[model samples]
Each structure stands twice: as C-alpha cells, then as structure tokens.
Target: MDFLNYAFMQRALVSALLVGITAPAVGIYLVQRRQALMGDGIGHVAMTGVGLGFLLSTSPVWMATAVAVLGSVLMELIRWYGKTRGDIALAMLFYGGMAGGVMLINLAGGSNANLSSYLFGSLSTVSQPEMTAICVLAAFVLLVTLGLRRQLFAVSQDEEFARVTGLPVRALNLLTAVTAAVTVTVAMRVVGLLLVSALMVVPVAAAQQLSRSFTATFAIAVAIGVTVTVSGTITSYYQYVPPGATIVLLTIGAFLVLTALATPLARRRARAAAAARPAGDPAECSIPATRGATDEVGV
Candidate 1:
C-alpha cells in the first residue's frame, strides 16, 4: 500500500502490469516458434536504436520500437529465404548492433549514466510520457497477438502446412515478429535491454512445465508475469534494489520452484486423466485432429 502511495510507484505499477501482460502473451509464440533467443537479438538491435535516438535527439523507446520491428521483419525474411544459416544471421545482428550502438553513443556524446539505465533496469528513470508510451504500445501488442492467435499458432506449429492451407504464412510470421518486437520494447522499460528476455521467456517456460495445453500455458504464463512484476516491484521498493533485476530474479525463482513441483504433480494429473479414459478407447490416446477442440500445438 505504501508503495502505491508515491506517484512514481503508481506509475511503476502501471508499467509493470502492462509489460507483465504483454511480454508473455507474445512470448508464448516465440517459445512455440523455438526462437527463444530472438529477444536477445532484438535487445541488441534496440541498443543501436537507442544510441541513434540519442544522436537524433528523439525518444529512444520509439526509435528502438521502430528499429526492432524492422529488424524482426528482416529476420523473418532472411530465415525464410536466406541461403545462409538463420542462427548466423541473428548472431551477426546481435553482435553488430551492440558494437554500432557503442560507437554511436560515443559520437553522440551521450551520458554514461543514461546509457547504463537502458542496459540495466531503472524504475526512477521512467517518466510520465514514457509510461503512457509503454501502455499504448503494450496494448497494441496484446491486441494483435490475441487477434491472430489461430493463424500464428498454425504458422508456428508447421510453416509448410500453414502455407499449403493458404494461411498467409509469410504475413502471419511478419505480424507475429513485429508484435514480439513491440513486446521487447515495452519490456525494456521495466527489465532493461540486458534482461528483458528473461521476463518474457522465463514465465512462459515456467508455465510450460505445469500446463498440459497451449491455452493453459498461455494463461498461466500471463498470471506468473503479473505476479512476479507486482511482487518484484514492491520488494524492490522496500529492499532498495533494481526493479528490473528484482523482477527477473523472482521470475527465475518461480521457474525453479515450478520445476521442482510440476513434474510430480503433472504425473499425478496425467494418471488421473488416463484413469478417467476408458481402457479400450484407442481414440482417446490418439492425436487431436488439426485445430480440433483441444488445440495441441505445444502439449
């Protein structure tokens, strides 16, 4: 309650809530796509964008969002059609962007203190305008992700099948990539570029351990994201710690605990579900039909 009393803390709560919802929503797709490292790639690109924004005297987050979106689209394109290795492409951008950002920052004569804030986490640095920007972008990310859930799921589950089915596989891939980029931007404000992906990926991983289906995992990841964000923010306030690191550490801790318990609990539940099924029913053990009542993309 005391944490909520301060205006900055109020702003932090809102920021955390928005990212908490937005990050894992997009994260589910990234994890499903097996591009979990995409966040790290995007993070490095964002550093370059921030440096350029400082040079141009613009809002770094907006610059980072635009660059990251563009970067993501290009990433999809290269991976889709490039002769070179996809991971190599991502790695090139990852390292090159960070190097460029350093040079750009030096040329721009930007402050080390300000740059450090983006690299790490700094709740005090979040201003009113930044908070509002995070909200708008985060909301947009959530809307697109949920709206295109089916198509996105198809693309991730099997790109060839999705393309054959006339699902606009390329377009859906681009859209999801951009949405993830936007998610990366919003999360950077709370978790910093260095560890933004942890907030996005860790919760989803934790949820995956416990969930038996895609929808259940998605819901659980969002819940975990919110829980960690709120709890970490409050704890950071009282402990005088960096909120971004605090939030991420809590998420990691949750994942560990979930790992310790999910296996046994999942085994028991699986047994119960099997017991509920008739022993002679072969259909119950069969795979679900394409996009059936129980969408089995991840489970």
Candidate 2:
C-alpha cells in the first residue's frame, strides 16, 4: 500500500495492468493458430530496434514497434512462400536480429547493463514518455484484439476456410502479426522482451485446460494474466526482485494450479455428457443359441 504512494510505483502498476490485459488478448489468436512461440520470435526481432533506438537516441518503444512490425511481416511472408524451409529462415531471422542488437548497442556506446532492463523489464524505471507510449500501444492492441475478434478468429482457426468465406485472410494474418509485434513492445517494459512470450502464452494455456469454448478460454486467460501481473508487481516491490521474473513465475504457478483443478472438472463434464446421451439399440445384440444347436453331436 505504501509503495503506491511513489509516482514510479504508480506508473509501474498502470503499465503492469495494461500488459496483463493486452498480452493474453492477442496471444489467444496465436495459440489458436499453433504459433504460440511466434511472440518469442518477435521479441527477438524487436531487440534490434531497441538497439537502434539507443544508437539514434530515440524512444526504444516506438523503434522496437517499427522494427518488430517489419520483422513480423517478413515472418508472415516466409510462412506464405517458404513453407518447406520456413523453420530455417525463421532461425536465421531470430538469431540475426539478436546479433544485430548486440552489435548496434555496442556501437551506440551502451553496455550490456543498459540493455538489462529492456531484456528483463524494469517497470519502476518507466519514464513519463514511455508511459504515454505504453498507453497508446495498449489502446491499439485492445481495439484490434477485441473489436475484430470474430474476423481474427476465422483466419487463425482456418486460413483456407476464412479465404473461402471472403474474410481477407492475408490482411487479417498480417494484422495479427503486426498486432502481436506491438504487444511485444507494450509488454517489453513490464515483462522484458525475453519473458514477454510467457505472458502472452502461459495464461492462455492455463485457461484452455478449464474452458470448453474459445470465448471462455479468452476471458479466463485475461483474468489469469491480470491476476498474476498485478500480484507479481506488488510482490516485486516488497521483495526487491526482478519484476519480469516474478511475474512469469507467478503465471507459471497459476498455470499449474489451474491444470490441477481441470482434472475433476473434466471428469464432471464427461459424466454429465454420458448421462445426457440418448439411449438406443446396442450396436451388437446378443442372440441366444437355438435349441437344436444346444444338442451336442456325439456320434
């Protein structure tokens, strides 16, 4: 409670809350498409932008967003055109982006220590400009994720079907990727680039264990995300721990707890389903042996 008195903590909490809401919102789509790790790839690519920002003496948040968007677009194109060798291309992109960041940051006269905060998050250090940027980015993310849910769902669940339904599959895919990249930047300060994927993915996974529908899963995941983030941020403030690591650990804890609770829920649903099933003729009927056949041939 006392920590909230400080302006820095206030900013940190606001950013953490926003990150909680937005990360899982966009992440559910990625999980639907079986591309849960795409957030990690975008995080890697955004590193170069962070470095470039430092070199150019600009805001890393916006720079990382620009660079991440381009990288995500390229990744999407590779998915389209490089189906067979896409993994290799993505590998190169991830590592190249990371290496470029290291090199550029060196050139910018900054050391690894300077990048430590961005790499692993330092919510307490967020400045007024960065806070403004985070708010704007979060608004855009919420608009895309919530406002266009049905269209994004159609594309992510089945691209070919979405195309057949005239849903602008390509545009939607690009938008999802771009939105995911922006989410990476939005969460960069709260969870750090390295751990942002966990915020994006773990809550969704946890939610899926207990949900029967996409809508339920989405709602549950957002709830779990918000729970862990706010709690973790406060814990970090008191414990003097790394906020990113603390938040990620708490998310994992929520995942495990939900997973354990899912077993009984699943069994309850199964029993209910069995009871509600319509009774009908058995597929295989047992016929009694004929009287004549019952007599053994002893000859």
Candidate 3:
C-alpha cells in the first residue's frame, strides 16, 4: 500500500496498465495477420518522431504519435505496392526508419536526456502527463479495435476473400495500421523503442498456444501482458534490473513454459487423429482412385 503512495510508482502502474491493455488488444490482430514484425517497424519510426521532438524542443510523445501514424500508413501503402512480397517491403521500412531515426538523433547533437529512456525505457521517469496520454490513447485503441473487430478479423483471415465479398479491405487495412501505430506509441514509454516489439509480440504468442478460441486467446494474451508489466515493475524496483528487459525476459519465459506444456498435448492429439484413420483406406494412403466402371483397385 505504501508503494502505491509514491508518485513514481503510481505513474509506473498506470503506464503499465495502459500499455498492457493496448499492446495485447492490438497484438492479437497483428499476430493473426502475420504482421507482428510491423510493430517493431513502427516503433523504429516512432524513434524518428522522438528525435524530431527533441530537435524542436516539443513533446516527444506527440511527435512520436504523429510519426508512428505516418509510418504505419506508409507501411500499408508499401505492403499494397509489394503485394506479392510484403515481407520485403516491411523489412525495408523497418531498417529505413531505424536508420533515419539514428541520423536525426545524431544531427540533433545527440542529447542523451530522453533518448536513452526511449531507447531502453525508464519507468522511474514516467510523468503524470505521459500517463494521461497513455490512458487516453489506450481507451481510443480499445474502442476502435472493438468497433472494427469483425472487419479486421475477416481481412486478417483472407483479404482477397473479404474484398470479393464486398468488404472494405483497403479501409480495414489502413485502420489496422493506424491502430497499430497508436498502440506502438502508447507502449513506447513502457518498453522503449528498442524492446517494444517484445511487449507487442511475446504475450500474444504465448497465449495463442494455450487458447483455442479467438476470444480466449485475446483474453489470455492481455492477462499475460498485464502480469508481465506488474511483475517486471516490481522486479525492477527490488532487483535493480532494467524494466524493459525484465518484462521481455518474463514474457519469453512464459512463452517457453507454455510452449513446453502445449507440445506434448498437441503431439498426443496428432497421434490420436492418426490412429483414428480407417485401416487400408486408399484415400488415407494417398493411392490413386480408379475411374468409373473400371477394374476393382487392388492394394
């Protein structure tokens, strides 16, 4: 209880809550779409925004938000342009953004004040204003995700099918990119630009192994994120470890344990299905079928 009384602790907790909710909510969709790396790309783009903010002596969060949004949109456009090889497009954007950010930081005389914090994360420095911004962003992200859940899910499953079915695939893809940008911006403070990808990807990855339903997977992912945030903060406070690293490590550990637990069960299910197949079934054995009115097939 006394720990809650501290301003820094309270700020950290609020930041954690906001980040945990936003990241996992957005991440479930990212993971489904196989665009998990996109989060890391946007985070790098956000560093450019932070650097610009530093150069202009303005609010880094706002700058990061704007840059992240632009970057997200650009990524979607690139993905569309490189439709057949979107992964290459994404990698190009990620590396280009990272290089641009570094250049901006260097050009700005490299003030280490907020840069390092953004690089490695510093929960101890979270301020009231930043916490408020995180809360607002989190609420907005949740609302948008919920409102577009169906469209997002459809597009994620099959964009071509969705387009053929008259769904607004382009608009949905843009909306998802925007939502991802906002999520990355909100999470940047908690995990930093360097490691924010872990926060976005790890929990969801772990949850997917344990959950069979979409809703169940989303819920478990959020739970895992929140747990990592809270536990990481506490560990950082007592053990003097870096918060971002701690959170990432905890997330990785959870993923490993969950994967280990799921593997045997998954294997058993596979074995059972294999055993259930009818013996001597030509279809099961991949044998060619005989033509109509042809001789009886002999194995």
Best candidate according to TM-score: 2
TM, every model: 0.90, 0.93, 0.87
The lDDT of model 3 is: 0.85
Candidate 1 ranges beyond 4 A from true positions: 273-299
| Candidates by TM-score, descending order | 2, 1, 3
- lDDT per residue for candidate 3 within 1-299, as digits (tens), equals 56687899889988887787778888888889998887888998888898888778777788889999999999989888978887777777777777777778778887666577888788888888888888888888999887878888889988889999899899889989998899888888888888887888889999988777888988899999999988888888888888888988999999999999999888888899878878775444555565565665778
lDDT by residue (tens digit), candidate 2, 1-299: 89989999999999999999999999999999999999999999999999999999999899999999999999999999999999999999998998888888889999878788888998999999999999999999999999999999999999889999999899999999999999999999999999999999999999999998999999999999999999999999999999999999999999999999999999999899777767773445667667576576888
Candidate 2: minimum summed lDDT over ten consecutive residues — where? 281-290
- TM-score of candidate 1 to 2 decimals: 0.90
Candidate rank order under lDDT: 2, 1, 3
Clashes of 2: 0
By lDDT, the best candidate is 2
Runs off by more than 4 Å, candidate 3: 83-92, 267-299
- Ranked by TM-score, the better of candidates 1 and 2 is 2
Cα lDDT tens digits, model 1, 223-286, are: 9999999888889889899999899999999999999998899889979988898878775455
